[model samples]
Target chain A: MLARPAAEKGLNNYMNDMFAFDETDRKIVEQLRRNGRATNQQIAESLNLIASTVSTRIRRMEEAGMLRVVAVSDFAVHGYHILIHLAVQVSGRPALEVAEDLAVFPEVFAAHLVTGSYEISLLLTLRDIDELPPLITGTFAKVPGIKSMTPAVGLDIVRYALDTGPVDSRSAA
Target chain B: MSRPELDDLDRQLIGILAQDARVSNRKIASDLGVNEGTVRGRIKRLQQEKLIAFTALTGMKLEKAANIAFMAIQADTAHVRRIARDIADIPLVKAVMIMLGPFNVMATCLYHDLDDLHRLASGRILEVEGVTHVETSLVVKTVKISNRVVRITDADTLSQG
Candidate 1:
């Protein structure tokens, strides 16, 4: 597990301190869940409200730092055939610095400071198996303060989602 | 596509929907303490504005399948699109994208093993016109994967202001 960053402590505290949501907020969110790209007009029609009012609500939600919209590609359709996950252990530098360095690599899809034997976890895409040796021996090992690395390739993705379903009312109860 | 304007309420709504995509409009209205009609209106507007999009998430664990490889190709700028389209037609190719920096094209494919990967790279991928270089990385493991974007909603706001 990676050690939690000091800045994260403040962010986590803030999240915990946040209050609950009311009904309209929940409805707006549900519509977004179904289609992040759904038009404001369509949402208005679905929920039956004026366009500008819906726009205001969306603006408010954005200001609160709840969610975002982005283009998502099916990597499978692309030429990247190999997906490699690397759990890297670092010794000298701060984990965040290492994460920043790893992020510079275009092949690296995602990097996280996680909790476990490793300090950083990386998601990467590559063209073939031959590229692995160079990445491990050349790119990663060269990073200062890097101690060790463990990699786990995904064999099958059973179930995964960007968002964990709505906060259960039962959990609050 | 351009990013959209969003406020605090919009952020809250997105967060809620991110958690559960299936919640009803009535339920959402009830949770946010607003008229159901109002909730419905906002959702339509967000969709029309292209602020968010939804698609089924599908993934396969390549390690268990016995074959996996990453194919990087360098192609002439003019022909990159054509090459990408050709590669996409292959059955084993799972994903393809244009990248920045050293490489021009990055693709992921699934196969039986080393022999299978070799055949695809040499025969199918390399065969594409204008492909200058091909580099393959056999995935060892997957550490983390998520389609979520950071600051997608607010990053634009800060920039605009």
Candidate 2:
């Protein structure tokens, strides 16, 4: 009985350490979001802080595994026109193992282990629609735990961003 | 295509940027064995074309802490685009996609918790005109989230067809 409370306390502490970011850290993150290629000096100039301070904050964020600077290219521009969201159900083995397997494919952009109608979900970027069948039959067929795979071909993607945005009470009314 | 096509040099620049968006132009130019002017010109063109963007992506740690849901909706097919736009405007919606499979509209949203997800899914999502059905699945774990997943192949082949 004592172990359970101690475990809960530890978990809470862990989460607090993981997500804790002050105002300055958040500001630096916002600046980086605006221009990921911005140099430390440029960010410092824009934020009105020393370059070393900006660099240190960024380095701290990087070390904490909270952020990364990456190039986001339009899939259609690079010839991978078809974007399909896959809902996969796993049964025979551990879902995490199967998800890890799915992540190895180059076409897969995001893979998540979830609960509901499906056990795993994936965002697959195919060069063309023709590549879908081969991928479904050849690659996915070999995975041991997959029970079903449902594909939703993206016709139009309206918004894709990281910002969660503020809570809008209008929705509740 | 309305956008300008990428040439070999453009592809090379994009490929380099895709690896490390923060890499300096001088470094990229030296790595690609091209003049700085050429690299700068191609990067400017790519940015103007909206073909490539540099941004910070939230890692899986933050995603895991948040309540991420995959919400699929079936609305009147005619108003699917309009509904998509409305849903996109809703707070916490990370992505909204009009799909062509079992569901007409699919979205990924972040919520403060299960209660927050319940409010959005049961409230605004259901109240939307023409929306007939809604299915929401809470994400339990994120295995991978990457922006640079596409492999760069032959530039000519990628440019054509």
Chain B TM-scores across candidates? 0.66, 0.78
TM-score for candidate 1 (chain B): 0.66
**TM-scores for the candidates:** 0.44, 0.79
Prediction 2 global C-alpha lDDT: 0.70
Residue B69 of candidate 1: its Cα lDDT? 57
Per-residue alpha-carbon lDDT of model 1 for B1-161, expressed as tens digits? 22356676666565565444445778888999888887778766654454443421212320223344566568787877777767766766655555543556666566776677778889889888888888776654433334532112321211110
RMSD of candidate 1 to the truth, in angstroms, is 15.9
Q: Which candidate leads in lDDT? A: 2
TM-score of 2: 0.79
Q: For residues A1-173, write the lDDT of model 2, one tens digit per residue.
A: 01124554355445745555656666777676667788999988877888877876666556555666666565556576778999898997999999999899978878888878899989987777888888899988998999998988898767665432211111100
> What stretches of model 1 exceed 4 Å from their correct place?
A1-173, B58-68, B85-95, B110-120, B149-161
